[model samples]
Target chain A: MNKIFETPLYAYSRSPDQESEVAVRHKIVIVGAGPIGLAAAIDLAQNDIPVVVLDDNDKVSSGSRAICFAKRPLEILDRLGCGDAMVDKGVEWDLGKVFFKEREIYQFNFLAETGSKRPAFINLQQYYFEEYLVARVRELQAEGKAIEIRGGNKVSAIGVHDDHVVLEIDTSEGPYNIETDWLIACDGANSTTRQMMGMDFGGRVFEDHFLVADVIMEADFPTERWFWFDPPFNRGQSALLHKQPDNVWRIDFQLGWDIDREEELKPENIDKHLRAMLGAEVEYELEWSSIYTFQCRRMEQFHKGRVIFAGDAAHQVSPFGARGANSGIQDTDNLIWKLKLVLEGSAPESLLDSYDYERIHGADENIVNSTRSTDFITPNSEMSRVLRDAVLDLAEEHDFARPLVNSGRLSVPCTYDDSPLNTADGLDGPEISRPGSTCPDAPFGDGFLLNELGDKFVLLTIDADAPELVEEDGIAVTRLEISAKDDTSGAIRRRYLGNEPTAVYLIRPDQHVAARRPNYNENLMRAAIRRATGKE
Target chain B: MSDLILTTNIDHADDFYAALLGAHEGLSKADSDALNARLVLILANHIGDNDILSKAIDAAKSSG
Candidate 1:
């Protein structure tokens, strides 16, 4: 890492900034140095686009906030060059045990089938996650990539122009204005940019507040998601326990709405709850404790003129599903490539609307899942409680009802089923990576299918010669011709080739399937490419 | 997803109805109310379906 990023926190000395000089312009400026902003910055930087990131705070988040990192976000992070480090640092687990009162109902496994690179989910502190991302950015920057992280610089105001966005940034010395071709607002849930624009952020709030406590203790608890509903220790409420790195345990107790926040967070009160949950003799030191009332809300559109919103700035949801930071990272994964293409003028500006459409749909999916988990855990009415208890009781005996056991329905990547960018799936290929879905990873000759694909449009032809294809816009062609023995051994034919003699799949810059043909067809590929880039 | 599915999901609707009405026949107002609450819970547990339970709640809350 460069000296500029060697220290994660601290106010930076001012460079010869263009405060009064003619407003300095950049290709793109990202607000907030959280996971989403840093992820987007890395995405753009990988595309060789110059990016500047502004953060109000120095260093990463304080505690193990947003501990659960889902596989989808891990995959996205892997592309940006920090996935392995996170996995190494995180505690990986997929099993979850749901308890009703004293007896255990059932245990569920997420992504039980294996051979995938990343696990279903990993528990890591938010600060470490951001630290890895910032480190990745530094690695890219050291490689002569154009990226800058200005810690302690906050966006004072945002002004949208017809073709550019002007942002006034506040620093210790003074404030300066910088214009960008586009501004990505990843300033998180309390986004100043969204408030400045006065956008309508609408959704429901889960009134039940939750006490989050991170305890640094070595306990003989299994590395699995353990959730208790109406347990004797918690009376009529719910509790969750998760394992993070550094032998720290992330504990959550659902306290219903209408309680004094101060009283709830008092050390004595926290000590009582901890003693009840972990027994009296468990030795531990309090790492962190806080209370939060979550919400499942989102903006109507992610993009407004040259300014765009990503991550928590655009949407929010309860912490139940581990969707908050993971979805935000996915938001950048969906936005950066499209923004890059639009910036390079290879794609029309209308291409960015697909980001809003696909991502709003994605956000809505998270909100719906979070809302469901919230309701299931905390019943809204007496009837609701009765109904939930019935299901839980039934789950103990009947296998059919076990599926209804909702313990924060784990996060997964949302497929863009109705994306305008997708051509209908008519081939016999696997549904896992159909059109408008994340590109499935399979062992190619030596590397993975995803590794072969670049950060640009590709024409993937399995077991065939390179097509005499017309490369549209800046789309690059990487012709892959795998041998038959390796094909079956790698599960490549099973996942992608199917029974087709020659299969062709058109992929977009964001690694989403745009279209696929049973056989090579240049005209079909060209049309799909045009539609994908908003050129049609 | 739930409609007031009236296609006789239960095996013996007539028998269940007879018992339901008979259970409330000779009870005072408070006892009848308690019986109704307990009955609702029992049947709800037996049903074991949120969609159906929610529909039943809605139907009971609404006046014909």
Candidate 2:
């Protein structure tokens, strides 16, 4: 057993609010101290917003779930001060190989370009990921940042009010009531908050199950993603292998729908499957094993009045693309800044609707990709299987067929193509860095570009002049000026500037571009800032 | 003008049909279906035009 799960990091304790005569009101109350909830708490606390996180469990997740962390979320974690520890402990890899039968068909590298701060993806167990986040929470608490994570505080009931939300929490001491100005539900896919609120989560439930086994063993397999389709050991089904830290390897075997849950979960049965895949002589211990049936679904709206949903509470996708936790981290990234503005009265509450709009777009994109990957991995019909196998057969020899092969598209940041907040394109810059796109990280002087952006709105000028500070609707936008000539690697030029000699970009707090122009204009910059903050 | 050559463009239509049938002469029903699927994919790749492929699909569906 893993030692992290045995030790309680945030054990239950009595709180002053538990003994109060009246239900104490907090600024924000986040439910389920998973990756998403902890990230939201850390982000809100970093911005000086008081937040309290409630979780039913005190320890990290028992199993090594959600093993792949993409680059964008790593960058978001960097802003929250937890990226360094995670990256140091994670197994970084960008290459993935797809196999058909006994032979390799094709391989892909996610990050072929250079100058990015983080890799395309990293494999770190969810327990370590949560531990690092909890460590960051403790650091912030030490700094007197108003943040609290109460373990064993399970929210049993919720009352929605126009201005605030009231929560009934069950604790070891007793049941206590608390109120908050707002509620952010980061509770995972089986969200109790979502069920209690009676929000409808609608989507397709795939008809297949997958057995995930985390085996601790010493193996010489390279640190890369290896996916097999119809292998000898697992005939007519797909399998996946990934390396994690501490010599733990994650193996996923596609188990058909009609499987005996109890029989398959037996240790001897799991060991038999492992022996077949890893050969009889390879020594390994089954650290964790479980069967899961994934669904691609989401609520219609992320927020209803004072209660808001983020992460798995808001949406869910098949785990094939690593979109589950990565997108959940992005939810907090897109949400916390807007929440801060609303809390400070700097922006209207309606700005949060854009969170629903943009994140729904993101969720739909993930669902489509995840559904496609699932369909390819587990073909439903005879014709679908024939076509899928045909593609794999041709992919081994043809370069064009390689693109047709589907083995989890992998997680990537979604560009808000039709976001309401985006100002019309005013510059002929690179399409990849256009309005409504996350700013691509490039190597700047001594550091990366995203590191300099931090967590605030900024006017990034490249060989263009802009005011040092621009105030719009009580929101301050600072300027970060750089010259195109100083770019030694030309990554900035290729990513941000395309044949444009100078560029001025208004970047949102989440590092997404609000607007961009060839040169700065005071009225246009202010208007972009207003639109981005929902003051327009 | 459409990219898909709907009009007959094969120099020897009977020869092409014979070759297509000859490829699956000794296959079972399942193997024949698999061969047809692979052949469609190969020809689709050779054509390499989405609009043409979509039109061909419509034509095939209507014909069936």
Candidate 3:
């Protein structure tokens, strides 16, 4: 049997929802089919949670939206089973060059270090990401994972209850209501769910407007992030240029506070800037153009009883650092495990509150970074412009000013070093791979450390005896022995075990380090497992 | 490093100069002077070398 490949965005035909099929209760319902929404749905389905996803649009979103995906989000997408496809489809970048006017002032070389599996970042059209996620969800569904996606279903109303949520969705056929045990709002920045609840989503909104033009051309531009404080093309304002998958180059021009949106988006207006940047001879087609004002804000709480918000529904940041979608994807990664545990009644609902707390910290970190980048690029006051340019000028010669040069601090996975979920590191180890941080990926015998760890609460023992962990539903324990043969170079030992031969790492299903001890004992392992699975 | 690395480092000197002045386009005389002072302070901090900054201080003041 031949399986025909379908275009994800446009091929989704709007199916009618019957009024009689309205009142059925669902385990999980996710709103929005963007990268984050589909990711949430796919993750839940992978965890054996039956989910129904709704979206206002039937087709994948247009343009080179959210092209830059950081490595952490890439890892999260990998766990959801879509990382390879995205990396294969996208262009990998490990270097970025920041220019003061036409002169290149500073450059970032992420030239991969030893034991690093993924590149620093990759650029792929957001539509392709959505497409791959949808494909993965369908594959999971075929395996009886129980995930249903309803396109063209706009959630018109949301009623959050103590035990469940009732959503009034309007489809092409008509309007109907569906009750969900848990409703994950993966809706975007302008989330209808956010508005329906009238939650105060507060943050800073940048005054400057940026026009993003995805220009399709066959010309060869090296895969690297090129950012400018004041480029030769867009004078007095900042500009950015990055390569995308389909010979489409995303060029952003800062248009300041006032500009006619329609007038700026015109072909001639965009062509003038493109001609200036890439030279007049480089012929290109304008694939997509959009004008946007960057904003950094988030809800104080992402959870409201049964209705929980993830991604842009909960927070938004200026897109300079490519944190918007990347961070949103991470939100789903942080959320799904806790959500699955709560749904299965294996863990107290308070476990989900940890998602709210940790992700809010993540959002706040993103907001701080994005806001600083926005301020640096588009100086708020006269003195700000002075110091910003000074940093750029100094950055060309001095190493000290390089760190201060905030051309969208390249997205790095934030370590939840002080998370409540982590058993405080009682032993000594590298700070980077400490508890409350992501389980550092290291080359295993033939696979990676993270690949062997996730999908369950697993313990990794370095040349040590395996703790006799009792097998229980949602609380089962498995041990992985990382001996010298498993990693001949001792990369796992260097990153995870430190100098100790018998270090035990209790990793969560989300691949975050829950607790660790240099001396692995039955009592310590049992206690950590209980705390990790939300037992005690 | 000491020589005037003409503003045209990447072949857009004239355009860049125009843009630099353009940053002061709508400013008053006092504001334009303030921008120069700020640029000077910023570049000095970036240079960070007392000896080099001192040289620049003298060079910018000295007549061609």
Candidate 4:
């Protein structure tokens, strides 16, 4: 990292003070037209907020950076109405296979759970996702909404004042000045905006680097994730084959720490590795090959004054568990609503500060989990190598150890504790009963589901005889209607209510149960609503 | 996403302190409480859950 970037005062993506009359003002200005930035633009614009999306790129890039989109991000995409299109184009996968020395050791089928039309995971190209989102942004703009997209516009200077931010944008025609109420930096890991804000991105870069290549293959392979540990083809190397949309495959090879960088990116080098791994006389054409170094780091703060950070600009984790892009999209999901609230005058500007509060914590947690996974996948020390080997060996005898063999570091759905929104009932014990945990998806009624009830406030009443609570305009309460006599969705009743005197379990939009009351607690319920909406 | 609410290891109180008030950086209880109040009001607006949102506001003010 550059020393200038290390300083909190550094500003690299500064807007240039250029001369042009194409000046426009918006309620918000978003830099970098990536998926997260585009999502924010579409969301705010659809909500009738004036937004300008600036991107230096003229066209969508080829290949997928983030191949797998988890359910949470999918929900956010659904909110923007862009998810359905992506869902149609993407391939859904629920099963993954792990191999040890050419023998399949264990397999995980995510569809083991009931009550979901959609699969647990989807594989889609990042470019296609962006392409679809950009179209949606244009669609919103055509309806006379306030959305201005400035392509090939390089921001030269960013002048932040008391109330608004002024940007010096250099467009294809000339330099122009654009001002906005708020500025969001969705620039990548080497973020110019994050550097400009002078926030320190803290973490270590691993010594080893991996080669990633996407290629078209002639041979047919199982529609499953194939991973190898300690392969003999390339001594001390691990390889993976992931099925893509077409007959193409995304392959990743862990080249030891000391491989020649220039030589490794060559097609012949990739061909040699592929030939050895495949062991078949198959014709393949390499599409893209690059060396990616893993760095696990997060910014100290996600916000500084009116300028805020999101996505890679905030944190960059290794590609382990497919967390990099997934987490960035999550940052968008968390920030967009808060920014919308602040912009709409529903909450104080201090509410904007929580953007940093929650997302920085989220990024920090991702870095920790991702770093641990990276360590397991590519153990650096001798002790780690031996330990990893031992665990894989244990999988041969123990079914419990199978996940370890598969490098299955489950992605944690983040929950917040002590959040300003947490209620007393939310603070229950046993760690697993923590207030801000990720709400689990389970079967509800016939063909109905639990996670499907998200995207809105859900008040689940367990007490059938409890007095009627007035239905608020925005909040929706569903009586689980479960008692000793009820056995429909039998396991769900046993799981959440659990013989406790739980009456009403209030779940938030993010699917987390906010407060569980044994009976109707009007005061607590009202207070919880106020906290969730900033109406108090 | 699965419908099972998977709780993390951290508790709500500690998460609030670390995430919102910068408790890990040595924020005073009074300041944390004040932040807690401000955040409760703000987050109430963000949450779609009315009952919980209202409860959050009460908890914030009463904490102060």
Output the number of the lDDT-best candidate: 2
RMSD of 4: 14.8
Interface RMSD in Å per candidate, to 1 decimal?
A: 13.6, 13.8, 12.6, 17.9
Docking model 2 quality class: incorrect
Question: Can you tell me the DockQ of model 4?
Answer: 0.01
For residues A162-195, what per-residue lDDT tens digits would candidate 1 score against the true structure?
9999888888888888888889999999999999
Q: Write the per-residue lDDT of candidate 2 for residues B22-61, one digit (tens) a residue.
A: 5665666688788888988999999888999998787555
Residue pairs that clash (backbone atoms under 3 angstroms), model 1 = none
- Give the per-residue Cα lDDT of candidate 3 at A25: 82
By summed lDDT, the worst window of 10 consecutive residues in model 1 chain A runs over: A1-10
TM-score of chain B of 4: 0.41
- The top-ranked prediction according to DockQ is 3
C-alpha lDDT of residue A324 in model 3: 91
Predictions in order: lDDT? 0.81, 0.90, 0.80, 0.67
Question: On residues A1-536, what C-alpha lDDT tens digit does candidate 4 reach at each position?
Answer: 42211222211233332444565566788998888888878877877888877877655545567787777677667767787888888887777776666566667676535533345667887777777887887788789888766667888888888888888877666677888789999888988777665679988898888888887886678777777787677567677788777676888888888878998777777789888887758688776678888898888788877888888888898887777777788777667766776776655778666667767777777876676667667866554565466556555545544544435344555777666656766423234434555555445545434535545566666543443444543443554454534437555455465656545666655555566666766677777766655454
TM-score of 1: 0.88
**Taking the tens digit of each residue's C-alpha lDDT, what string does model 2 give over A37-140?**
99999999999999999999999999899999999999999999999999999999878999999887778787545898988888999999999999999999
Provide per-model DockQ scores: 0.05, 0.05, 0.06, 0.01
lDDT of 4 at A256: 80
Q: Is candidate 2 or candidate 3 better by DockQ?
A: 3
The CA lDDT at A196 in model 4 is 64
Higher lDDT: candidate 1 or 2?
2
TM-score of chain B of each: 0.62, 0.89, 0.74, 0.41
